[model samples]
Target chain A: AQSVTQLDSQVPVFEEAPVELRCNYSSSVSVYLFWYVQYPNQGLQLLLKYLSGSTLVKGINGFEAEFNKSQTSFHLRKPSVHISDTAEYFCAVSSLGGYQKVTFGTGTKLQVIP
Target chain B: EAGVTQFPSHSVIEKGQTVTLRCDPISGHDNLYWYRRVMGKEIKFLLHFVKESKQDESGMPNNRFLAERTGGTYSTLKVQPAELEDSGVYFCASSQPGRREAFFGQGTRLTVV
Candidate 1:
């Protein structure tokens, strides 16, 4: 079974402040990792994914994440946040094969305080 | 190109009522998935369809829930006699074969009172 754990349920940060949302996962086999963001009343939008190659991945809206293998973590970060960045973030995992099922975390609500 | 689309963005019904949600995936995408997020819970996978065939349904809660992808184009998920526990946001996603990323729809918010 593949499962994703988003450590924080809510995060508050001032505008232009740096922030990080932690995520961890456990899987018996090789897996793919992804981060998605959802604005109020909207569906999930892909931010970034870690399928192969570099451990550091860059995504839209000045967001990025690092995949730490030993720690089993995929933490999302942003150097400076904007009020528009306030949204719910989710970490997801899937097996490393074609048509694999994707599992998602509980989600972290990022509240950007202007 | 258009993204995935789902209908009845919000629905409210009493317990034991029936509801059917619809989804239209992006054109040419062969993979469609169903997921749900209950109150204060993570989004959980419900099923996957590949070109009108069910690929995986291990996450389906029970027989009360049924999903179908007719003609490999649009899909529908029906919940019969829904319980209070079934209230949540239902999301539909789609991706082309061999793609790692899946695009999501706006989702159907079902409120079972």
Candidate 2:
């Protein structure tokens, strides 16, 4: 079984400021990591994922995440954020291979202010 | 392409009542999944369906919850004798068999009052 932990429950940042959302995981075997964003009253949309290969993975909307195997972390980062970036972000993990159940973190609410 | 969609975006029922939620996965998607998020909790997987066959159902809370996917296209989840703990958003997601990404639906918010 795999579990994901997103440390920050909420992060408030000024518009145009860089931000980092921390995520950590615990799994017995190799796993896949994912980041999803959800707007109010909407479903979650995939932002980025780390399946294999490179440690650094870039995703849509100028967001990126790095998979640090040693630390068991996959942290999402953005150089600069806009007010539109305000949303709830979640980190999830699933075991490698086939279709498996995904475990999600508690979620982090990003509030971008002007 | 049309994304995953769920019917009756919001449903309200009293405790001990019964409610059904529906989901339509993206066309041609072979893997469908059911997940839910209770108040102040993270989303949790309930089950998985590969076509009309259930691949995994370990996450199902109890027998009071029933899920069915007929003809391998759309799926339905039913909660009988719903409890106050069942109040939350139920989400449906789908992906290709080997695809790493799973597309999610808007979800059906079930409120047990």
Tens digits of per-residue lDDT for model 2, A2-82: 889988999999999999999999999999999999988789999999999999999999999999999999999999999
CA shift at B56, candidate 1, in angstroms? 0.4
* DockQ scores for all predicted structures: 0.86, 0.81
Q: For candidate 1, give the lDDT of residue A54.
A: 97
Off by over 4 Å in 2: none
Sliding window of 10 residues with minimal summed lDDT for model 2 chain A: A94-103
Place model 1 in a CAPRI quality band. high
Per-residue CA lDDT of candidate 2, range B20-110, in tens?
9999999999999999999778899999999999999999999999999999999999999999999999999999878879999999999
**lDDT of residue B81 for candidate 1:** 83
Q: In model 2, what lDDT does residue A100 have?
A: 71
- lDDT tens digits by residue: candidate 1, B1-86: 99999999999999999999999999999999999999899999999999999999988999999999999999999999899999
Count clashes in each candidate, considering only residues at least 3 apart in sequence or on different chains.
0, 0
Q: What DockQ does model 2 achieve?
A: 0.81
**lDDT assessment of candidate 1:** 0.95
Q: TM-scores of the first chain across all predictions?
A: 0.97, 0.97
Candidate 1, residue B40: how far the Cα is off, in Å: 0.7
